[model samples]
Target: MRIALGLSYSGSSYEGWQSQLSGNTVQDQLEKALGKFANLPIRTLCAGRTDAGVHALMQVVHFDTDLQRELPSWVRGTNAFLPRDIAVQWAREVPAQFHCRGSAISRRYAYVLLESPVRPSAETGRVGWVYRPLDGAAMREAATHLIGEHDFSSFRAAQCQAKTPVKTISRIDLSQRAGTGSSYWRFEFEANAFLHHMIRNIMGCLVAIGQGQQQPGWLAEVRDARRRDAAAPTFSPDGLYFLGPVYEDLYGLPTRTAAYDWLP
Candidate 1:
């Protein structure tokens, strides 16, 4: 049977979500823990692959396992074997055809920026920090120009492997908040899917706007440019988080409670 697992992790200690040969990865630890808990080989296919130093609040992964374990036990047992950095909040039996990645209708990402003059504290490794004061209102205005479908090549990573540069951005919002006594900014985006480093690149452009390097109308021009070099530099990965995937229909869980609840 197919099983779905909700995951959350701190990206500070690993090389990204995908299992790699060069260094430790979140997928490596997860597969290992699931293997130990199930007493058999198990492989997971995730909703999306996050880059190195990027966090995920509600990443989803599916695996086929024949073990007859209770749903709650699967959650607890798998988490027991996993390290402190990664947690499995819930698990549920899923239909064989329900794929974690392919079935996702949309994905939401949140990028954080510590934009005050003061540097962020040590506790902010996974969050982004900028040394200059940012204009949040200007950033928000710039973000509005990016909404809707467009060829986002200007904001795409040069090394992106996706064959197409076109993508539909459902929404983009830039908001400010009072951080742990400092000013901060949050950049949020929802899309059908994303290209490699897309969020980071968007964040970079927005930061440039906040810093007065780019005008609010520049985003529209970048979208029309359809060239990677036309945009600002790719921002740091520290601020990126894979918030969660949105499914249009129920994924065949036993109960609504069984749906991924790791999101906050």
Candidate 2:
């Protein structure tokens, strides 16, 4: 039988999601807990892989098992052995054909930023920081140039393993709000798929435009360059969050997390 589970984690203390020789990844911690709970080895494939210091509101995974445990037990039991920063949110039985990654139609991500005269403190590792105020209008204008299908090589990482540089971004929403003495910025991105560090790289450009360091039209020039050197450096992963992937209704998985309402 195939089992699917929804998970969430704070990636600050780890080296990204994929299992590595360091044995300090979220996947390693999760598999250990799942194995211990079932008293058998378990392996899981994730919907998407996140980077170091990145976070996930909901990450989906699937594994094959014959333990016959109830769905609630899979959730509560596996979580019992997971670290405080990692957790299993929900679990369900699915058709053997279901896949956590290949079945997804698109993915969503968000970057929460803190813009203030003084640097962010308590929010240091949780949100990206910018000392200058960001211009939402300018950033929106720049984002428009990236709305449809195009080569995003300028924003991809040097080590990106994606087969193609072309990607389709369905939406880019930027919002701002005033806090006690600081301003918060939320940048949301939805795409058919993302290359390594794509969001962070684009964040760097949008932020530059927001701070008036570059004009909104500059985004088009960068997009047309098809070279990584043409764009700003990759932005911080501190504020990035994997909002999870969208799957067909046949999967019957929950789309949103409780944290959704609290976000911008």
Candidate 3:
């Protein structure tokens, strides 16, 4: 049987989503838990792989298994061996043709940022910080240049293995809320697919523009340059969250988790 699972994790404790020799990645821990639960090794394919210190609201993974078990049992059992930061939120049996990564229609990610003179203390690893106040209008204008299909090579990471740098960004939504002494900003991105560190690279430029380091039109110039050096430095992975993938209605998978609302 083919089974799919929805997972959420705080990536601060792991290297990233993919398995590594150190066995310190989220994938390694998850597979170990799964292996312990099933009494056999089970491999999983995820919709997307995040970097170290990145978080996930809902990460979808699928694996083939011969053992028959109730969907709820899979969740409870697998989670029983998983770490406190990683969890299987839900599970379902999927058709053999359903692929966690290939079948995804679009992927979503969100970056939560805290803007204040004082760095984030309580939420240090949970959010990205900017000491200067950000200009919301300038940032929004700069973000408009990123919407629609375009070559995102300027924002693509050097280590990215994506076949093509051209990707379609369906939406870029920016919202802010006032906190006690500072303000919180949430940047949501929806794209057909993302190159490694794409969003973080773009965030660097956006933050630079919002802080008056660059003009809004500079973003257009950077996009047109199609060179990684033309963009700003890659931002922190702490605030980055893999919001999961958008799949067809036939799959019957949950897109959002309760943590989605808790962000920002």
Q: How many residue pairs clash per model?
A: 0, 0, 0
Best candidate, TM-score-wise?
Answer: 3
Q: Which 10 successive residues of model 1 have the least lDDT summed?
A: 255-264
Segments in model 3 whose C-alpha atoms lie over 4 Å from true places: none
lDDT of 1 by residue, 1-264 (tens): 998988888888899998999638999999999989988989999998998899888788999877898999988999999989889877878888898888888898888787666766774776788877788788888888888888888877877888888889999876777755576677789999999999888888888888899898998888889888888888888878888787756774322232225322
Residue 174 lDDT in candidate 2: 87
**34-95 per-residue lDDT for model 3 (tens digits):** 99999999999999999999999999999999998999999999999999999999999999
Model 2 lDDT tens row, 137-216: 99999999999999999999999999999999999998888887789999999999999999999999999999999999
Better of 1 and 2 by TM-score: 2
Q: Is candidate 2 or candidate 3 better by lDDT?
A: 3
Off by over 4 Å in 2: none
Cα deviation at 16, candidate 1, in Å, is: 0.7
RMSD of 1: 2.8
Rank the candidate models, highest TM-score first: 3, 2, 1
lDDT for each candidate structure: 0.83, 0.94, 0.95
Q: Estimate each model's TM-score.
A: 0.92, 0.98, 0.99
**lDDT score for candidate 2 against the true structure:** 0.94
